[model samples]
Target: MTANVQNLNAERYSNEVFELWANQQNLNKSEDYLLKKYITDTSKHVLEAGTGGGRLSFYIEEKGFNNISAFDVVPNMIAHAKKRASTNDSNINFSISDAAVLENYESNSFDYLVYLQQVLCFIDKKDLFTNALKEAYRVAKKDAIVMFSFLDYESKIYNPALSSFVNVLRKLRSEEQSSRHLPWLKINNDINWKLFHKNQPKTYWVKRAEITSLLEDIGFSIEEVKNANQFSKNTGKRKGILYVVCKK
Candidate 1:
């Protein structure tokens, strides 16, 4: 299940359309606020996980951050980011690496870590999610600050649609569905308002308490938990998505 989820996510993000879309995006309000508020030292070594198209990394570089290392599991996304870096003449280190396993990064190396864009919730199972969190803890320096985002299970937007039906069928056959697994089963027309639908990867929606418990268990001190919209004072929008800051 883990391999399948990983492969599907890689393929989904590797799509040319999605890559272009990701590349064009800038730091959202929550991300911008967190970076401004928490990351005071730009010269310190920073690591970013699931850095799709180098969006956040590019933003950080523009803010005078010199020692930044960013990685994404999808090869094409990393390739696109490298191309962007070359075009911009930036020195941000971009690589292909999985969040669940940071085999290439040294322990206690990064002074800060970035895991935004709801990247953690993409892992299929709880154990793998824990492993990913454990990796985050291992790679961070003492007192290193880490910021991550997750899809909120309490948000009605994440309530199972295709997953609900799929899980019912699986249960009838005595087959287990991966926990909190919700697939992108609806049409998204955000690209120039043109409707398109595709069978894509699943993302796990997590309860607020559940993620906090896991982070604390993995030895991170929780700093703050806020709805993504709170940063913009737009409390009514995107209510179920959350961003959290912690210290190692």
Candidate 2:
């Protein structure tokens, strides 16, 4: 992962208001289909990787999933999450962690793990992304459900997030060279499209096949895969984040 990507991830989600926006996302749905369908027992130990501002953590708690812990690479984001947790009196253990290296967690510690909101895309290096998957796989128990979501390369428009990153690339390189030297490098046999989001820093995207193969390689079985945005339709069609549900 590039230092630029790391700095960007830290800089973007520093605000407290973003947490409210994150929580507001699933209000329309009567059920968290991903959580409800895959996670039946509220007692299961849950971990939210890349838990920005603890929005999903808060939501999962509302649904009675009490055994939850969350982490983020950004300290300010974790601070915001901690503030929210304090306000709500939620017993969620918030911590600082890198997905590729779960320094604090032990193997087989959690029953359910969620890498939501395209957070996986933030690890700019494909190998780092894979290593993170390996860590996630290691920490989760057998038959555990793991859900990862990302912004699709085939999205209808270039989101503001992409625009910000593009602008950064443009600044680093001459317009002529940047056109050629974008972040989309073809790494060893992984993904042709590991595009990260700009606004949210390390947030990025990869092909579904690459994700599936990587998960299987790391011992996860594919259960269901779909665009997370499918739940929220706009302009008469589903548009937004790509996601997968896997069982370990």
Candidate 3:
């Protein structure tokens, strides 16, 4: 089952496609802010789950984090990450591992754990997310920081233009094999063809209350939930992202 999921992800987002998608998204400002907030005044071990292409991990390394490890479920993604590390001469340990299962990492082994963007949504299992949280908590010292971001559903409904743009992009990616807007090569398999045709890849939306409640249920207290509008002074329509910082 895990292998199937990995293969799907690999086929959907190959190295070229992943690079193109990463380049298209102007996420550096937000990612930099979040990384600074999480990696401040601490010299403890850090782990980035779902570290596709080692993009965020590399950014964190550039910001002076010495002890950092990264993992992705897809082997091809991990391979791309390794190539990235070598190209940049970074010493990050890139591995292929499931975020939901962290039994190999010993208890109290890390001081920080981060999941950028929509890493949690890809799990497809609430129990798996809960278990991942539990494992993160177990492997962190008291007061360790865990930070992540998600789509704010409330804000999303207010931006029809952006919503329509996303829909059009999805449609283009699904229908046009030669669309350079997407990074992955054209998939020819029937299952993949049906999957892509039926499911448009849009952002996953979660309510603030639901996120806070989940953190609390998982034995972490939320330190802050920074709406994107607060930092940018943009209207609610522009603040489609939410960043949550919690302490374990």
Candidate 4:
């Protein structure tokens, strides 16, 4: 079953809320580095899974990449993305589709596949996640690249304030029980306060060894695994996220 939070009208949340926490820290530069480093210079076909609000898509467009496509499971989010695309006069394709299933698209049609922020964490099942990767590989060119960022579970556990807040939100969402088992979080309650609190999936803190092994098992060659903070020096003391790039 899909997470209850995924069923919520996420587009109702202001776009500003998505940027509020990261904007202050200049994390966009780090994200840009991940994009530039993994995305091939010759790549024209690109796909972004779970492209929420199209913030990163806009950045990709600004970097002059044409033939970009993005999709989100939430229809409202797609509506907002379409609106944003219209406002910006961008011709990028936007669609509403589940991340776990991309079979409708033609195979070997893309050169790069990107999953930004906590998109991986939002997928609740390991098989589903693996299938998504398989689909990415199928849709990408023989040597195409797939890049994504993930939270470091170790860092989250060590931070008292953040951990406490996370636990509280998880409790409110009724996800505390399964939080440790799955990467994605599900908030079942419709309470306004809980909605505002925002509980996210627990970080798997995927180590380089495990990630590399998974990639190899899934027919991908591991290329780079860098602490996203390395690119954004201002991140300071929060070694909670890593950017990984793998080739098909």
Candidate 5:
């Protein structure tokens, strides 16, 4: 992640407004389906990246997945997760971690890897995104299942005109430019959010073919790929979030 985007995301997620993640009670239909279908072993070691407020961690633990390790780059998020775990007497180990540089974890350590919540999109640069995927491959055991999710470039939510405008603006300023580099908007009531709204931070979007090719090149066997509507009844759109189930 670039320093500017990283700092922006840290500010966005660290705000108390995001602390509501602690009380997120259930997985969406897509997450629920993917988890039940590919990750059925209750005893396996599960590592969840970008575990905002421990939502997935808490759900899986409640479902009997005892060996769970979850992390996020934002310390305030991790603090909230740890506090929730303590309150619930949960066994999950919540920690501060960056997916692109997981120095604290050893190679071939986890049996299952969960990179959902469209966490990869937050990485606005391609090289750092690839590095993060490589880190996932390194920490996962051979043949371990890795579930990933990405923001779909084809989604109706992505406005091509806005993307083009952003590209032109950045190019004029001699900044890096791509159609996939779109701004993050304010979705909460943080007092300082308007400042960020004016100077928008970006998130990278991906297409199915692009991510499929990248994952295969990085030594993962693509097992399944589904768009939002295909994966969940609630999504109601064909081109929203994309989910992929892969193996090392």
Candidate 6:
């Protein structure tokens, strides 16, 4: 389900976008408190998936947890993060690796693994998304904390229609709009969503039950499906983000 080079290149973690994102994130205060409440002392060695701009690294470090390793699929994002690393001397391990295939990390090495900002949605294909979860499970210690977020497509604002399909076609053909939304569905428990971002390939939106079942199938024990908006004042589009705290 990898999008072609044409689609992948659109807004694909460019330096300009990441700079704006990082700048806005630096102003956020509640995120630190949110992570602090969930992260504990047992998570000495932490791994973060989809380390966009490495903003989470700062909040993670602020809580006195230094042994942090993070990675992103985009080389540009990693380069920017590494540059930011040079200025802070945080020593965070930032690398380039796809979340779907994390061949670099060792099994059972991490106490905590996190993939935030609705990162799973980018893995639009259900099979690869499952494989990614399987990889995350493989890399975590037994009973380790596995925290991540999912974007719920059941939001009222989301109305996938013919226009949405047209938008996707335009994107794939590079004829018109750079980005568009397509339908999202729970086909027998496997989640699927059409590409919305102009860049990158694959898209996925999930239901709570579908995601819970997927995690259980991957051998993770359920802890709680947290509503993340409670921790922040996010509304409208941002309100769909759901944080899942599970054990592996």
Per-residue error for 101 in candidate 3, Å, reads 1.0
lDDT of 3 by residue, 1-248 (tens): 14333344545556425665333324556676777766875367888877877777887787788888888776777888898789889988888777678755778777888877656555534556556667767877788888877766666554455445545766766643212112211333223333234333322356788878988888899987777766666554446478888898
Q: For residues 182-225, could you state the per-residue lDDT of candidate 4 as single tens digits?
A: 32232232333432245433333455566668778878888877
Model 5, global lDDT = 0.82
> Please, what's the RMSD in Å of model 3?
7.5
Best by lDDT: 5
Question: How would you encode candidate 1's per-residue C-alpha lDDT over 78-178 as one tens digit per residue?
Answer: 88889999999999999888888889899999988999988877776667888999999999999999999998877665376645765776577675447
Q: Give a tens-digit lDDT track for model 6, residues 1-248.
A: 13444225224445325555444355233345547666787448989887777888766877788799998776777787888888988888999887778889989999888777766666645666778889999999998888878766554354455447657666576853323223334322454343343433434667678888989999999886655565555444435567788898
Which candidate comes out best when scored by TM-score? 5
Stretches off by above 4 angstroms in model 3 are 1-7, 21-27, 158-204, 234-238
Candidate 5 lDDT over residue span 1-248, tens digit each = 24677667667677744756545777888899998898889989999999988998888888889999998988888898898899999999998988999988999999999999988788756788889999999999998999999988877554687677777777776776456767764455443444223345567788778899999999999999888688645444566689999999
Residue 124 lDDT in candidate 2: 52
- Quick one: ranking by TM-score, best first? 5, 1, 6, 2, 3, 4
Candidate 6 clashing pairs, residues 3+ apart or interchain: 124-203
**C-alpha lDDT score of every prediction, in listed order:** 0.79, 0.70, 0.65, 0.64, 0.82, 0.68
Rank list by lDDT: 5, 1, 2, 6, 3, 4
Angstrom error of the Cα, residue 148, model 3: value is 1.1
Residues 10-30, candidate 2: write the lDDT tens digits: 554554234443344453341
Clashes of each: 0, 6, 1, 1, 0, 1
The runs of at least 3 residues in candidate 1 whose Cα sits more than 4 Å from the true structure, single-residue gaps closed, are 157-164, 173-175, 187-200, 234-238
Provide TM-scores for the models. 0.88, 0.74, 0.74, 0.73, 0.90, 0.76
**How far off is residue 236 in model 5, in Å?**
12
Q: Supply candidate 5's per-residue lDDT for 187.
A: 55
For candidate 6, what is the TM-score? 0.76
